[model samples]
Target: MASASLKAPPLPFLRAIAWLRDGMYALHRRMVPGHIALLELATAGYLSQATCAAAELGIADALAEGPRQPADLAAAVGANEDALRRLMRLLISAGVFAQRRDGAYELTGMSQALCSDAPVTLRDLLLFFGADLHRKHWTHLSGSVRSGGSLWPELEGMEFFEFADKHPEAGEIFDRAMTSVSSLSNEPLQAAFDFGRFGSIVDVGGGRGSLLVDILQRHPSMRGTVFDLPRVREGLEEELRMPGLTGRLTFEPGSFFDSVPKGADAYLLKHILHDWSDEDAERILRTIRAAMESEARLLIIEMVMPQHHRPHPGKIIDLEMLIQTPGGRERTQTEFGNLLSRSGFVLTGVTATAAPDCVIEAHPAW
Candidate 1:
């Protein structure tokens, strides 16, 4: 079976492609009638909703075996035949699925990613994005923008983590979505950094230990621990059972705000600091710093937002943090350096990974 992996070109080549893609977009905007282009932009939300609907209805899964007539697909997924046909037609226009002359629909490359068994399935991520709670959060985007804060606390009467704790189903979907995202970054991380240098590593706030498992599997001699909340331990049994990890990988249950596991050769914080404000991020960092030996390294994996106005995924994700989490935002390299200094660590080096995230290395300053 195929596994999710990153096969990106070198960074310079990728940047060149990005520049070309941006130029094409600009040229299209100039060539198309202004009103028509603006209309398409305005209607973009419709496409998002339609794609979410397709994922929710399992349209891609039903067609996984082969092409199927619209009526047959509707029956398989328990949807209205005419409505399913219309939805499939919209998706076809968007290049998600295709229809044959015989009136049967088949998966396009885009739709195939929605299949549960795909090499890099995005179905869980789509479902989480389209979940009712997420939609509600986005509806309050204006409030967050105006206040320069998240609306999650105001709407849910608690912080995002607490809300997740109380709602098991929502939490499960979020965890699954995060794991899917981790899969996308796994190979890129292995290629970008030297995890083998550390004899032992601890993944702070590492839900279910997905990244750590991938790393330990790559470096057979390296030992790894996943430190997360007690609830996250529920999923550890399955990962622990993965072949060749019987003794090399383990999970430790706790909160980073309190403390992290001590004295590992390296401490990895992947996508963890982005969930907090500078002050709170420092608290978590200080806690980790206190637990670390002077020689130990700290590895923070996150998107380093570009200082300029170039297009980056982190720019959009920063908005998501604004609406979803209190005092959370993606940081620039300088911002990261300042934050590490404040937390008693010196920014050492940064390695750009093939994925959107970059590996930032730091050491205790004092």
Candidate 2:
């Protein structure tokens, strides 16, 4: 509140200027995300509920062949035609689906990715992330904001992994979601870095061998192994039987907190460290240090926080991790370098990938 003595008197023209200024500010306030988010929050419930129905009824997968009218899609998925049409109308207006003038509803690119039958779909992510309890858990995000602790146990009375272990269906969905996330990461990361130099590579905490298989395919001469919990080996073995990579890959079941199998010329960890705190990351790095051969190099494929953030998505993801897990977020190069140094590794170099991620490499410290 400016005092009357401090406030400048306005000319008639200046009053118009003030009016314009306030009007523009009011417009901005109305258009900004928070205003949009209030709308989005209302719509999010519809989207999540619709997604659950789609996953349950396999609507997305069935629609992949082409556009279909509501009655046809409903018949294929064993859903009610009028109810399906109503839901599709909402999704169409939201840009998740498209409608022809002929009254046929079609899947858009975004909706296509939500289909499980698609070659590289994130259907699993869409389904699991939109599951009722997951959304409910996020609704209590303020609890996480105030306490800076894990929300899974608070939400479900079980730790995240513990709940997943008990619910096999949810566990399968969790694993599938991780594997499918590589759908977005694959082309950008695989094309950006060259694997010709490393004869053997180890994927730390590689889930289900999806990424390992892709990497091995790109470099046929290179041998690869995926290390994850014992439960992951079945999927890895199934991946081994895939046409091109059977003989060149293996699966190792072990905890990264313990010693990793260390003879590979290169160790790859994608999206791993961000899930843990600095102390935990260092503990894992120390295990890698003890087991890795003297010549082995380490690669961390992750999002690096930019200096002087204007607005980076990784910052949001960092906050999300802070709420959902023990860790805070992606780090700047300096932050990662500091961790490497403290964990007996030397930062060799960093390479930015074509995607919004980068590869930070290191080796055993002298």
Candidate 3:
């Protein structure tokens, strides 16, 4: 007779968990190289921030033509030579500056981006997001996770916008940061969608009107209106008045929560809805829906999260929303479908922009 032998059946739950674990681990392993780069870049904030300060102080601009000794550079910026040398040393290691045999410092490619004279200076964006506002407010990220609320008010003793309004420097920094981000999306979006079909485009909650300007500039046939709070309108007006964009763009100071100016062929809300909760988002969407001109299409430019286990960068950006906004995070296509339906619009499809974000297009219900 054969001795009794034991056999085991597979556990589905255990199998599923194992699969998930392996997937996430594989992703992490693959991401490790990029992760290392990001970590090194981020940890060198001293160099980054100092570079911003130098840009603000015209250090890079001063070094544009040639290298300069520490003594001369520091004197120009009103700093001590020894201390300035130390700062330059840090930046040199980060590849922003190069050291010469004579102890002078010269600019590098990355340093060029930090220069105020550069056609596109990330200087303003870096100085704003990398310093006081980010430093103080980012500290409350843990609090945001614990309560699912904004850390701005708790950290700054006032809401984010309010604090920015009261502090002009902060406001400028905030506006510059927003403008920089919007500029990145503008061209990609212009190429992705045809604005020539629409006569009037309304940009709801448009900040600085950078994207609006880009779209109008690209599609000369289109005229646009920017709708936002008075403060944001101020920033928009600032951009609109700069010679070229004047006649092409108009500014309407109002709230998205109230009403978006009607009579537009398309209603554009880029980077807006994600700042609000489902309830508030629906409210805003309904307001826009009610005001939509007959035959108007609604385009929402936003980051879309993947519905399945597939990895996407929006997951990290969702955490940024969690820490900064009250009740906002990225959502999937199906979730957006429901959101659009609740607001009286049916999502037709998504347009992939040249930028990393996607434009979800919907039409008002007939």
Candidate 4:
């Protein structure tokens, strides 16, 4: 479990950092020749691939003991010594790894996070993003843009979720990636919001019940349910076996498009709505609305895009949604309010967490 203090910095502090970072980038652009700056931007994909390669070869894990010569690292991770050395040099330049004067490579702060045993590992998340499936989908970004829709279903002849369902290996990587990503936000989310108010909560579309587990761990007396597809229930028995969650946590496999469990104090939807378009998202909201009592709250956990759009990670994730899902998108506060209104609910409040996600609370209109 992640520490409670892993929350995001204050918004004002973050804004200052972003301004400084952007200023530095602007300074670099001004200092460099036009073509040099353009070339740097163009070659960013190579860096991404290099990082992915390092991760796949377990280079960080290999260096976990201490700095090792390229020959030793190559042998440990089964790579060509010369090629591995070149890769390490590039990563070192990018501040991922460091090359000591002794001619050995070691993990940098960035690379340390890539190690499997790190306090918070992004190794799985990197693998998932760098996977061929995601790479192939990104290649169709232009087509999606032109069509004003997702190219995934058209290209693959199936929806993204369906493809994941059909391919177990791919599904496992995706699930692990989501869980890994969730770890970054879970602690911050708990710290920002008050889940203790809800004695009974249902995590709608909750895969593997990780969020619910986190919540249950905090609120001991709070009973929780993980409502997702039947396939999601596969390894949930293991989740149920966790120390404090034995009786308080339960798995209820079902589709949010159809219905959610009824009469819970709150319905949680973390990272769920962003994977769907307005129509489908509305259907999901309406389904939950039908299941909820008048007092029940709908807690939507997602990246609420900035209306003005200065610089937010959600902006980048929106592109991923565009190329991958059929009409899925990150919504703005106004857009969310409208969506909730259409789904027979009123937007109550929006609470920003330490993570990029915001808790958009809504209640049934009537």
Among all candidates shown, the one with the greatest lDDT: 1
As a TM-score, model 3 comes out at: 0.79
- CA lDDT, every model vs. true structure: 0.89, 0.77, 0.75, 0.87
In the range 1-366, model 4's lDDT, one tens digit per residue, is 433335567767866788898788778889999999999999999999899888888999999999998788899999999888888888999999999989999888899878887766788889988888899989888898899888876788998988888988988888878877877787778878999999999999888776788888878899999998888887677888778878888998778888889999999999999999999999999999999999999999999998763567999999988887878999999999999999999999999876788899999998
Tens digits of per-residue lDDT, candidate 1, 1-366, equal 123554656778877888899888888989999999999999988889899888899989999999999889999999999898888888999999999999999999899989988877889888988888898888898999899998776788998888888999888998888877777777778877998999999999999777788888878899999999999988788778778888888889889999889989999999999999999999999999999999999999999998776678999899989988879999999999999999999999999977899999999997
Candidate 1, position 223, lDDT = 94
Q: What is the C-alpha RMSD of each candidate to the true structure, in Å?
A: 1.6, 11.8, 12.9, 1.8
Shift in Å, residue 202, candidate 3: 0.8
Give the distance in Å from residue 19's predicted Cα in candidate 2 to where it truly belongs: 31
**Candidate achieving the largest TM-score:** 1
Candidate 2 RMSD computed on C-alpha atoms after optimal superposition onto the true structure: 11.8
Q: Which ten residues in a row have the lowest lDDT in candidate 1?
A: 1-10
Query: Per TM-score, what order, best first?
Result: 1, 4, 2, 3
In model 2, where do residues sit more than 4 Å from their true spots? Answer: 1-56, 308-311
Predicted candidate 2 versus true structure: per-residue lDDT over 1-366, tens digit per residue: 000111222235544665587677667757887868578667767776776666667777887898898788889989889888887877777777898989887888778777876656778777777776566767787888787776776667877666776887788888887787766666656656776689999999988766667778768899998898887776566677877777798888889998788789999898889888899999999998988888999999888998852445588778767766665477889999999999999999887654556789999987
Q: Write the number of the candidate with greater TM-score, choosing between 3 and 4.
A: 4
Candidate 1 whole-model C-alpha lDDT, 0 to 1: 0.89
